[model samples]
Target: MEHQSENKDMNHEFLPMTSVANNTGDQVAPGVFVLTTKIVNVYFIQCSEDPSTYYLVDAGMPKSGDMICEWAEKWFNHPPKAILLTHGHFDHVGAVNDLAEKWQVPVFAHHEEIPYLNGQKDYPKPDPSVNGGLVTKLSPMFPNHGIDLGSRIQPLPEDGTVPGLAGWKWIHTPGHTPGHVSFFRENDRVLIAGDAFITVKQESLYQVMTQKQELNGPPKYFTTDWKLAEKSVQTLAALEPSVAATGHGIPMNGSKLKEGLPHLAQNFNELAVPDHGKYVD
Candidate 1:
């Protein structure tokens, strides 16, 4: 498979902002739907028996409500039952308040992330001083404030089972953020990996915008601990997920996912780990 391509004219109209309802949202698995936002992906997992009551994972950048609503109307024809957050990153939670208010649904996240989500703790701002690509250099300008969804916020289930998402379990894969988590469906062997493992070098805007697919660890410059990040990758790799849809880039599966995961798990330091960046301690 080609690693990079000049898809300059490739119509990313399917990205949430433009053709939300028109595009056939990518299917990661049997009942999993992926709605691509500006550069990140917001997932919607549907219940086989009860289509109306689905679980939405992550909210894309601010003003993403229209895109999510457009897709939900065409896909579910109703509001989601709940919202499950992987973590409280600004880009991922940007539209949480708007969507929660519109649907009147509860939002659940790990307790460790509450401080960042409740305006009590500020996430480590992106460091433009680190060198990776243009995205890193320009990331300092991105918004980093917490969105107030106090009324809808709730702590994730202590047992790790997401309330409405049956057959799925939350895995605490910290490092990118102290409280970051990932979703895994053991029955189907499908993983909704967040920033714990991105398919592209997320620090590069070009890579994210172009949807390059590579099994890389969390974006190095932003990830706080190299040791923990490696452990997280090894832990997820042990599950041997047949399919994985991450925060950035498209979904990957089968031999490609299986074969690539070990390589990433073993040599994450050399391949995706930054030499000397802001968060490396």
Candidate 2:
């Protein structure tokens, strides 16, 4: 199945963001794959031996569930054993309820994110006033309410163990969301950096549309705590990921990742954080 066209009937209104996105369906490593949604991304962690036993990194935009499943079938000819989340945002969890039900798999997220994922809490409103561009301006209308995933959702293992994938650990990268996380594999230095950091300049309509590759912090409008966010970037950069893909923008690696990561972590105040926003101190 082809990716669905952009989701326009949502309660939230993002005028310019399209429904279909550039599917960066490429093999980053021997067992890792990346797939793009309208303006976000999801990952497929395939098992070399067991097609039925694998993992999904994050869920994508509202109506992109079929695209995700198709991407899985294309790569491994089967479904995943579980759905792991980085946080509970509309863009990231939009397709979660559907996919988790379809695959009959548990949805795992950081313990802190349970409130938002279980209909117990709502995220603070996005600061559209933050300096970025149209996307930032429209951010206020974006959905901040929690989804009711019911019994299908659970917290990631407290021991940092990833359920279906070996050698991967979930890092507590808060600030984007109280429970945001990024995945890492020390042996290969492969990082699946959720929104704790992203590769696109999310504030700009132009750059986000073009999928420009840049090392930017979490999307400015939605990020609530700058200090913790900065610390998270420093944490991921210290890992020195050889190849990295994020929630937004395209995949990046080599010198760009090597040089860009440290630079972003060191200079996030000026390079990534905005000057003014409700959450900004």
Flag regions of model 2 displaced more than 4 Å.
1-24, 48-52
lDDT of 2 by residue, 91-143 (tens): 99888999998888999999999999999999999998888899998898899
Q: Looking at model 1, how many pairs of residues clash? A: 0
Using TM-score as the measure, which candidate wins? 2
- Give TM-scores for every candidate, taking all chains together and pairing residue i with residue i: 0.89, 0.90
Top candidate, metric lDDT: 2
Tell me how far the alpha carbon of residue 195 in candidate 1 is from the true structure, in angstroms, after superposition. 0.6
RMSD of 2: 7.3
Query: In model 1, what lDDT does residue 259 have?
Result: 87
How much lDDT does candidate 2 score?
0.83
